[model samples]
Target: MENQRGKGLSFARRIYRPRIIGLGIGAISVFATLYPLDLPNWTWALLVFNGLVWPHLAYQLSTRSAFPYQAERRNLLYDSLMGGFWTATMQFNPLPAVTILSMMAMNNVAAGGLRLFIRGSLSQFAGVLLSWALFGASFNTQITALQIYACLPMLTLYPLAVGIVCYRLAIKLSEHKRALSALSRTDSLTGLLNHGSWKDLLHIKFHKCQQRQMEASIALIDIDHFKAINDTYGHIIGDTVLRHLSSELRRNLRHDDLAGRYGGDEFCVILPRMSQSQALDVMERLRQIFSQYRHPQVPELKVSLSIGLAAFSPDFQDPSSWLNAADKALYLAKNGGRNQTANNAGKSHFEQTQMA
Candidate 1:
């Protein structure tokens, strides 16, 4: 409901300036047609109010109403009705009458689409009937040079204003689309790539390695006994530990490296242009740094990581094979003991940074 109201308020603001410009210029066109008719003093006064004062009045009515969008639609209907009244008052002078009615139709269509356009047309017809009953109907087929000149400004300027508003709306919609796309690709908890996005990138990386024979490695990291940490401390502290690991990964990895949360209690990384030994050294450093992390709220809490490394090999059949190798290494690291790094090359090392 709040969002709908906000959109309504925005609609009111967007219509405000265009109404002012249209009515102000339209008054000039009406004045040109009425000048030769010798209309009564009250008729001239009403014209002045419609052309000069009504725009501001309409804006106030729409903006201050509880249902601003509905109020603005009512205001548009009023504009169309007034347009018909003036057209009849001018005895249906061709150029100014067409200009007034056509512009009001355009406004109704732009603001509320086809439904409002149909309603506004009915309002205009009612206005025409009322004007004819009051002052009688007459037609003025001949148009003066001055009247044509007066209608020119409305014909050109009003459409230009509407176009500018539409262009700005398109730009805002495009920006919102991009922001939504980014949110879809990112992990909510850690701001890393989500599992699906990470796997997509992995396939791309695998193809590049196959084609160029590039040196690269993939790692699977498990928080040692993460379920135990959550069971003892709560999910909040478990989340904190996960964020800490992700922060350390961002700090240690190269700019081109890709990292993602691989699901509960596990993270994955792709290290391009690095060999198996280099990947191992990087993982070992990360393990050491992370083991030192202490939760501020829970001073006694400590964390450790078990990381597995797998370098790209020509023998691998596909991206899944490469990922499976890293998974196997992770299994070995967990079995050898927690707080260690293991490689698919059949080597494992234990680092007693924190005692269980």
Candidate 2:
């Protein structure tokens, strides 16, 4: 299901909390190794500067710094290389902290490789393995089976632990984005697709119809004397009327049909696999349903929809032209009598309406 996949993807992109945990471990090591042993003045100074550089730069580059993909990659690669040089400077230090720091550098490199190569799962795994092997071999002259076992525990679990945390966060962030997107494309009052999305829907549906040679119809529905409702009651009541109509429209429409709030008190429907006459019958059903949408708060509230049908056939040039034909019939319905439907297949007025 889309919902479940979307949830999984969300988890993939969250903040890696282990980075902070690792940094905290580093901080603890600083006091245990540096303050107690008090290494050379130069070593202390260099360590302090390197400490500031790694966290600050990592936070800024990952969160704030935006660059083209290739360029960002090159920068990360540079950091990974410099990391080695930074660690090698303290090889002569008496403290084993530098030794542990070097192992941490392997971590930094593995983490960097993961960040750089999104699709290259093989490359990421290999890089992590190599980093771990080098880290083990560096501490001990020869990498024995015991050393390899010690490295395996962290190497196998670190990425997984951090990855799960991030994956969970990404889902929540994505939901926020999806909700905002939905609001933008929706009419708040009607809770239906607004006019903004209509053009795109029309094109997409047109392609579908053309491929399958599926009969499709467009209906323009305008609520008659809707202005009177607003005038007699309040705009608040008028808004409630609109929302009520929208709910019924959504319930009545087929899954494939699209209902949109075209503008103030005007609505439209796009019904697939329906000819003009069949569409008219559907509109009448909708009309009969609309006539009953009175409220206990406003008993006088009454509205009727005038719909026009246009079927896409060989005569119609395209979906846009077909919609225009529907609009022409809508005009006729409005002028002739309110709450009626007209079919405008192969009619000259449809072409004229398109030109206008």
For each predicted model, how many residue pairs clash, with residues at least 3 apart or on different chains? 0, 7
lDDT of 2: 0.61
TM-score of 2: 0.60
How far is 285's C-alpha from truth in model 2 (Å)? 1.0
List TM-scores for all candidates, in order: 0.90, 0.60
Which pairs clash in model 2? 10-170, 10-171, 11-166, 11-167, 11-168, 12-167, 14-166
Displacement of the residue 247 alpha carbon in candidate 1, Å: 2.8
lDDT against the true structure, per candidate, is 0.91, 0.61
TM-score of candidate 1 versus the correct structure, residues matched by position: 0.90
User: Which 10 residues in a row give candidate 2 its minimum summed lDDT?
Assistant: 85-94
Which candidate leads in TM-score? Answer: 1
Model 2 Cα lDDT, one tens digit per residue, 1-356: 55644443332223224544444344333333334332558655655554445545554454433332333344344443433433333222323333344444454444455444332333333443554444332332333343344334344454565566556657867998999999998888888899978767987888888888888888888888888878888899888878887888888889878999989988888888887667766777888898887788877667777777788776666778878888888888788766766668433333445666
lDDT of 1 by residue, 7-82 (tens): 8889999998889889999999999999988677999899889888998998889888888899988988888888
